[model samples]
Target chain A: MREAVAVFRKQILDTRKNRAVLIQFIMFPIMTIVMNSAIKVDDMPEFFYLKLFSIMYMAMAPIVSMSSIISEEKEKGTLRALMMSNVRPASYLAGVGVYDFQCCLIGTMLMSKTCGLDDGPWWRYLCVIMLGLVISIVLGASIGVLAKDQMAATSLAVPVMCLFTFLPMMAQFNDTIAKVAKFFYTQQLYLALEDINNVKIGTEGLIIIAANAIVILAFFVLAFRKEGLTNE
Target chain B: MISVTGISKSFGDKKVLDGVSFSVEDGEIFGLLGPSGAGKTTLIRVLTGQLKFEEGSAMINGKEVRKLTGADKKKFGVMMDDFGLYERLTCYQNLKVFADIYGVGDEEIATVLREVKLEDAVKKEAKKLSKGMKERLRLARALLAKPKVLFLDEPTSGLDPQTSSEIHEIIRKRKDAGTIIFLTTHNMTEAEKLCDHLVLLNEGKIVERGVPKELCLRYDHQKRIELVTTNGETISLQMDRENAKKTSSQIAEFLKEGKLSTIHSKEPNLETVFMELTGRKLEV
Candidate 1:
């Protein structure tokens, strides 16, 4: 537990010191909030802009933040220091994961309020948001593990940002793309946000959630194995 | 405190370390001296359990390296090829992070900083530090855990002579404190000055091993007497150890004729020994 805390404290220190990453952390969520407010138009479905912003926030923020964080560590060789130390893989990952989740949750709430989405029971609303954000965080961490540096991570994140955010937004217009997008976790998250109270969040939502969890875990193992994490 | 037997490691089909073995007793400084690509880094990685070895075992503190657990990691500190500093953080923050890992407190952190001469720069961001200061901070971080065994890879590789000398002094102080050290360097002078035992690694093999002076003597070439005459002429004459008596009579005749100004025997050094054994210069 102390190891995990240490990792957490170091992550905070590093992230705070990194202005590029800190700017992204602040800018993306505000972009979501501002974009939602700018597109506010009469006759629009209630909370329509909110849902779009939430999807964007859920998908892009964690990927950009987490990937940049881990890849920068690798590039700087700080990850090698952690690997050589007594800190276990799980402890380090969990520490970073918790931080990613907290940031995404804050973004979710900010977007929700800025778009004037009506609140249901707070716990149910939060649980749905938290679950969706975890998937994004895990997927982002995988990108981080694969990236060689911050620049590489940014290049890779561009296409991923488009795939997760653009695809779901595109699904609203194209029928065929909607059919394909339905299988993506980001798409399922948009659907869950659309019906926060009425949707079961059990059928397709559960399936995509379960599948992403497995895929993300596998991605971590494969990427970190390439990093020579197996010996430790 | 550190032992290895028949340790060999390969990357894909290329054998990087083949049948290399050595042990470092407690409180002794052992140097793994070699040129670039001589598998010095590879051997340290294998012993530290960062890389897996295919065909041998490394033990530290009576426990196999591969089998070492969390608490076991506390027994040693490693300053790997890359000194592994968080350049964005202040030096104190860098040391604090590692201090947290080793379960140490503020007092120990201050002591380590003092030991490496980094106390005044504690608040300085690591990237802002000069090269020598950065190396000193790296040493400070490595010593945070008060490790029984320390592994240093090219700690003074790129530093100037004065800085390198200072780093060497810190290493010697650690040795006096009874910490077993495994140092890897391409610097012959450093090896001669700091190492009590050393192995000459050449292309993934142990080409030679022993004390610096002993190895030099073991590979000693024929002794030569160099003379600087009063007429500003320099001359060298080989004197076989077995023919000392005959050479002594010849030297007396030269002295009687006032032909010799000064004469001294040219004994070999670690660099000469490395060149003779590897057929290559230590740095090149």
Candidate 2:
């Protein structure tokens, strides 16, 4: 546990020094706020701009951040150093995970404020937000483990970013997209958020979310088991 | 002490290490000399417990390598290539992380940085350091634990003479302190100068093993004697009995007539022996 704290502290300091990550954390939420004020229509959903950008942020922030940083560590051989210090794999993950999950929570808050969510009850928002963060982070971690470097991690993540971020946004209008997007966990997260005011999040929606989380978690474990930290 | 008995490892169908065996006692440097792909790095990995072998046994500090725990690993200091540095962290921050891992105080970080001559770059990020400085930082990180066994994989591959000498000085200090140092390099001069016992590994096999000069002398089968006369002329003769007998009176007359200015017996260096055994030069 002390080792885990040491790792976590190092990661937080590293992220603080990393300009690119700081930018990613703030960029989308700021963009969401700008878009919310600029684009307004009568028939549109209650918080269309907030919803669209928040889901996009969910896909982009945790997934890209975890994958890129973890893969970069592997690429640079820094992970090997940590392992040499006899830091357990779990401790390494926890250290990085705590900071990464904090990023997700903070990102959600920023995006939530784009609408009037800052004043509303936030418990339900957090419940689904936690689920979304887990799936994306695990999926991202698996990609990180599978990739040999940052470039490879980005290559592997681009399509995932597109499918998860854009598909649900398009599904808001098209019936065909809506039918297909319902199966995606990110889309289910959007629905859960949309109905949070009325507590109308469905059992079927919850099942899809849990199932995707399980599948991505399995991939993460498999990748980690196949490649422990870094390959020589 | 470190010990290994017939360790073997393979990736897929390709064998990276095959039936390798050696042991090192305290206060000695064991050098594994090989060209690229000679399984030097693989052997280091197996001994360090970063890699596991399919056969044989390895023990370090009286603990089985395969069964080593995180606490057991605290006694090892490894400086592998550039893979062990955090590029964005300053030299101090980099060492601080390891210091915290080793449960040492922050003062030790300053001490190690000073040891590597990197104290001046305490606030400089690792990526901004010169290659020699980066290597020094890596060394500082490895030495944080004051380890009993040090594994240096090509610690000085490319550097100026001054920096390399400084590193050699530090390594000598560690050896004098009774740390068992395992070094792998294609640099023949380094192995000869630093290693007490040298093993020549080629294609995952030990081709030769002994003290540096002894290995050279053992392979000096075609010994030759060359002489320079006072007339500035040079002549060569084999040390074989037949050749020595043929040239004895001629060499005696030259010596009596005061023509012998200089004489040298040519013995093979480690490079020649490595080439003779492995059929290739050390790759720079």
Best by lDDT: 2
| Candidate 1 whole-model C-alpha lDDT, 0 to 1 | 0.82
Q: For model 1, how does the per-residue alpha-carbon lDDT over A124-231 read when each residue is reduced to its tens digit?
A: 666776877788787778888888877888898879878988888999999999999988888887787676545357676788878977887798778877854222
Predicted candidate 2 versus true structure: per-residue lDDT over A98-182, tens digit per residue: 7788887887787776567745546677767777887887888888888998899999988887898888889988999999999
Supply candidate 1's per-residue lDDT for A15.
82
DockQ of each: 0.67, 0.67
lDDT by residue for model 1 (B137-208), tens: 888888888888899999998899998988899899999999999999999999999999999999999999
Error of 2 at A152 (Å): 1.9
**Model 1: per-residue Cα lDDT at residue A170:** 94
- DockQ class, candidate 1: medium
Model 1 share of native interface contacts = 0.72
Query: Per-prediction TM-score, chain A only?
Result: 0.88, 0.92
Lowest-sum lDDT 10-residue window in model 2 chain A: A192-201
Error of 1 at A226 (Å): 4.5
lDDT of 2 by residue, B138-253 (tens): 88888999999999999998978888899999999999999999999999999999999989998888899999989999999988888899989999878888777777877898
